[model samples]
Target: MKKRWIVLDGSNIMHWKGNGADLATVREVTRRLGEMGYVPCVVFDANAGYKLNNRYQDDAELAKRLGLPSARVLVVAKGTIADEIILSAARDQNARIVTNDRFRDWADQHPEVEEEGHLVRGGYRSGRLWLNLPDEAP
Candidate 1:
């Protein structure tokens, strides 16, 4: 069996619903990743905790409810660039990125992204989330 490691761009998917990135979308993506036989590790930008706050909950409260394990989610430090972090992790682990972001700014840093299978891009469509992976063609 092949190992399928996926590095998810957490902030991007949280905002995929048009309102904001939320726990629901994150869970949905996680579930789908598992169903597809992929092991996922989600990465978030600094201050991602703050952005989760809505009318009913704060960061800590939401975190408790979210119950994500430490190993599964990673948050970059303040002032650090998330793209670099995401790219580095993917490269080291030989994983693909799961995000709609084109990462055009980091083309020089991650040249492999331009090649097929380096990035898994997708978005919401017709009330459902859709991800596009590279085709298995030589």
Candidate 2:
């Protein structure tokens, strides 16, 4: 059987303000995803590494703290587009995107996200992380 994968929009999620975007929030999200049997792969904007300079040694360290393998966490190269890279990776793996972004700009690349179950959204409720997938609708 094919393994289920969840592609995370790291940049968008990390900036989710008070929602499911902080370091602890992301860790919780990953834990939930793992419990559900989905492999969570995260992709971040290249600048994410630089922004964390004060917090950790480098992006690798940050990823490690998040319980993510270097191979599973990708930092796009400078001048590259994070959204495009994320979309490409998700398309290649046939994974569902876990983000709050509407991705209006990348509609051409992911027209199917408008369809049910193609995109997954994350939210916090009662101090707990919750995942909402279009597929979960009855």
Candidate 3:
């Protein structure tokens, strides 16, 4: 697997600024990650559209917001948890997951959660997007 592959927790990142679900934050982050030479794979919960647009939106709609192809943007199936999907994608792709969540509950099953630089955490402190991606991996 290529080390440049990165998984983004779209469901969590959208709330980076605490202003509610904002796709702009996701878009900017995706753009920045791309600039840094990482291939972004964004995973969102099924209700992400409802939270952002007050209506149901498909993968294609959210993909447009992230400026990525529908294949790269995943809206998990209904009744499925997004965190699980995010972690699974990271594992499957041999990539790191970008999220503020510690995933303490899954630590027992996914020990990589405790590894350094495994769960890259970042958020906006003053309207500026920040990510803790390691220089080597990012």
Candidate 4:
């Protein structure tokens, strides 16, 4: 069997508020995925009009520090939507997507792809990100 591929929506994970996620949280998630033997990729939006500094650079640096390949960090350029890029990547790579966005409805329309949504909360448990994996590829 082929290894499962996980594509993460970078913007959603970072929350895109200038500051990246807590290093521990990011490491924990990545470590968990690694232990599960999944190939992980993170995609972030990089439209020229986004008006955010260090968008791609920050993500790239983090990915590098985390030992992820540059190819795994997709920065969508201007005049396009990240969703389109994500969908295309999922279709082309036959990978599973992870995002908190409402793209579940759109993903459900596909018959050959898998998607997982993460619900995160910070509290006594130091926050948790729950992954909702689909019953089957769709």
Residue-wise C-alpha lDDT for candidate 1, range 1-138, written one tens digit per residue: 987888888878888888875878877877777778888878777777778763334334433454545676777777888889889899988999988888989999789889786888776778887777643211
lDDT measured at residue 38 in model 3 versus the true structure, 0 to 100: 92
RMSD of 3: 2.1
Report the lDDT of model 4 for residue 32.
58
Better of 2 and 3 by TM-score: 3
| TM-score of candidate 2 on Cα atoms, chains taken together | 0.84
C-alpha RMSD in Å of predicted model 1 compared with the true structure: 3.8
- Could you tell me every candidate's TM-score relative to the true structure? 0.83, 0.84, 0.93, 0.63
If both were scored by lDDT, which would come out higher, candidate 2 or candidate 4? 2
Task: Please give the clash total of every predicted structure, in order.
Answer: 2, 0, 0, 1
Would you list the clashing residue pairs of candidate 4? Answer: 110-138
Q: Candidate 4 lDDT, tens digit per residue, 1-138?
A: 787777766656554232445434444555556676777776666642142343345456656755777767666765557877776777677776665565655556564444233322211122554444443222
What CA root-mean-square deviation does each model show from the true structure? 3.8, 2.8, 2.1, 5.8
Alpha carbon deviation, residue 24, candidate 1 (Å):
1.2
What is the Cα-based lDDT of residue 120 in candidate 4?
Answer: 23
Alpha-carbon shift of residue 116 in model 2 (angstroms): 1.3
lDDT of 4 at 134: 46
Which candidate, 2 or 4, would have the higher TM-score against the true structure? 2
lDDT tens digits, residue span 1-138, model 3: 555899999999999889799999889988988888899999999999999999988899899877899999999889998888888889988898889999999998889999999999988766677788776332
As a TM-score, model 1 comes out at: 0.83
lDDT per prediction? 0.76, 0.74, 0.88, 0.56
Please give the distance, in angstroms, between residue 13's alpha carbon in candidate 4 and its true position after superposition. Answer: 1.5
After TM-score superposition, the amount by which residue 40's alpha carbon in candidate 3 deviates from its true location, in angstroms, is 0.5
Point to the candidate with the largest lDDT: 3
